[model samples]
Target: MTPHNELRLLPWSGPDGKPCYLSTDTTGGPLSRLADHAESAQLAASTELLEHAREVLVDETSDPEELRLLATDLTCALRDALRVAASRGHRLPETHASGHGGDAGPSLPAAAFG
Candidate 1:
């Protein structure tokens, strides 16, 4: 199943003053969705790398260097995806007391992600 389907994500304001989400599941109460998104993308990229690695392993004359290159490519992709995703959200405290709260309170912007 798609990773998005397996979790519940709530809109949230990120460090960039943009809208993002906090994800949750049946088990974990609430977690950062950006992290989840990054992880999912990383997994997909890693899976693709594994496929390429397998192809290299199958070729009798394939050099071990090819596998190393594939690993490096996978690592780069994963890192970039994670960086992008993690930057999309900001962490805020779970609650705010009245009187101290103001118009500047953290909130998820409507179009931040899009």
Candidate 2:
């Protein structure tokens, strides 16, 4: 059994935003190391995506197709980022116990912009 302190939880989020920890007790555990490396890559991709968005915004002749592509990429990147945050035990800035917004599958909550 690995000692509790031998494990380090990365910023990576798990199921339902739970923190994912890497057990370092076994000096040569490949899975943990791989997970950490993948997480780092995800973070780097996010940074790159943000910078690209800035460039596109300032460019006057941005292509519509490129914009759509960017939107798709941004959505995936943002979701991953949010999952990492959630895994670190962070709430998603708002409590949406109710539905997301008006006519959003279920009727909107009483407080609109919450």
Candidate 3:
């Protein structure tokens, strides 16, 4: 089993809105693959939303209602992007700071920004 610090942070939350984690020795498991696909889709959606936001920002005729809707979408996209980043960051392998074997330092929590 993977250590507590090494558990994978799933891309989606639970029914109660709490963060979810996966503990497995291999990354090729079904759950891991599902999380991978979900993360990829989320990142793509965020990228597309960014382009739309840029277009709206450049359009001087955009109304207050449109801007408000855009803000809501951007907020959702930002949340997903942050979750993906946190998940990937946690999975990153620890590295030595110098030639000598030593702890690189404490890692950021998987849900630090959640």
Candidate 4:
């Protein structure tokens, strides 16, 4: 059986917005392939949305309604991105050559995003 943390965090939710997991060892299965495709689409959409957001921010004539809608879209994209990050993070190997333990790298300070 797969370890709890090793279970794949599926791209979509289950009942009532709860997260779903897959325990199969095989990565090429149908569900896995679907999740992979969904993740790819989500990331691509986020990239496009970011570009549009930059344009909206730069345009002085953007109305309040437009800004509000952009904010909503950005929030959804950010949520998806965070979910993808968490899923990928859980799947990382226990050790790496970086010697910073199993972590990817040093995390940025919270103020960096401010």
Candidate 5:
């Protein structure tokens, strides 16, 4: 049986909107390599966009339109980072507040992807 960590699939897509998944156990497998590269790229973008956000936020002369665009970029960066996180591990179980059952089963390891 596949490990639960490997089974933790993150539903995301490629630049062209093609569906993709990430699994750490693949090791040298094609999908594993692809996901690693994609995650790195996403991290890079997020880092740069974060710097841009700081600049935009502090610049008193920044235009409202430019600020809006920067906000959109930041949101995209955040989404990518979140996808990477989800791909590498399991998600939180549904809580009673969400109308789901409270029995959340076993807890996954902190470094489940590793």
Candidate 6:
């Protein structure tokens, strides 16, 4: 993990204006390492879930309800990953009008996820 001083969590708005998370660490510390691990896990899980969803979507014999459930699960996992990334101060590029950028000041609240 990067040093606490080097970590910067940029906030992005969520459904309820919740902060989006990202992190940038030049020196990998324990915390940064942990965050990296968490990120990798989330990424892998997301990929797996998405692939499952796709397979379900393409499987003509698959139950529609199961496909829906898988999609929902994928969405939830993605949201959780985003939250975790935000909590770690990972940088997230602004994609919407209300996104944090430019003169919007700090992207995330200093107290976010603390």
Query: lDDT: which candidate is best?
Result: 3
In angstroms, the error of model 3 at 109 is 24
Model 1 CA lDDT for position 68? 75
Expressed as tens digits, the lDDT of each residue in 22-96 for candidate 3 is 988788889999999999999999999999999999999999999999999999899989999999998887677
Residue ranges of candidate 2 with Cα displaced over 4 Å: 1-28, 90-114
lDDT of each: 0.56, 0.69, 0.90, 0.87, 0.70, 0.63
Off by over 4 Å in 4: 1-5, 96-114
Q: Which digits, one per residue and each the tens of the lDDT, describe model 4 over residues 37-112?
A: 9999999999999999999999999999999999999999998898899988987766554765556666889999
Residue 57 displacement (Å), model 2: 1.1
TM-score between candidate 3 and the true structure: 0.80
Counting clashing residue pairs in each candidate, in order, gives 3, 1, 0, 0, 0, 14
In model 5, what is the error at residue 70, expressed in angstroms? 0.6
Query: For model 6, what is the error of residue 83's alpha carbon versus the real structure, in angstroms, after optimal superposition?
Result: 3.6
**lDDT tens digits, residues 1-114, model 5?**
333344544435769886465545545667666666778888997898898788889999999999889988888888888877876555343344333665645668989968
Give the top-scoring candidate (TM-score).
3
Q: Listing every candidate in turn, what is its Cα RMSD in Å to the true structure after a full C-alpha superposition?
A: 13.9, 11.3, 6.2, 4.6, 9.0, 11.4
Q: What is the C-alpha lDDT profile of model 1 across 1-114, one tens digit per residue?
A: 223323222333368855454444332333564455556766686678768877887898877787778778877776555554544332322354467544455667889868
- Expressed as tens digits, the lDDT of each residue in 1-114 for candidate 2 is 433344555656678877666655453468756665766788899999999999998898999998999999999898777756554443123334545553424556679857
The TM-score of predicted model 6 comes to 0.50
lDDT of 1: 0.56
> Which 10 residues in a row give candidate 2 its minimum summed lDDT?
87-96
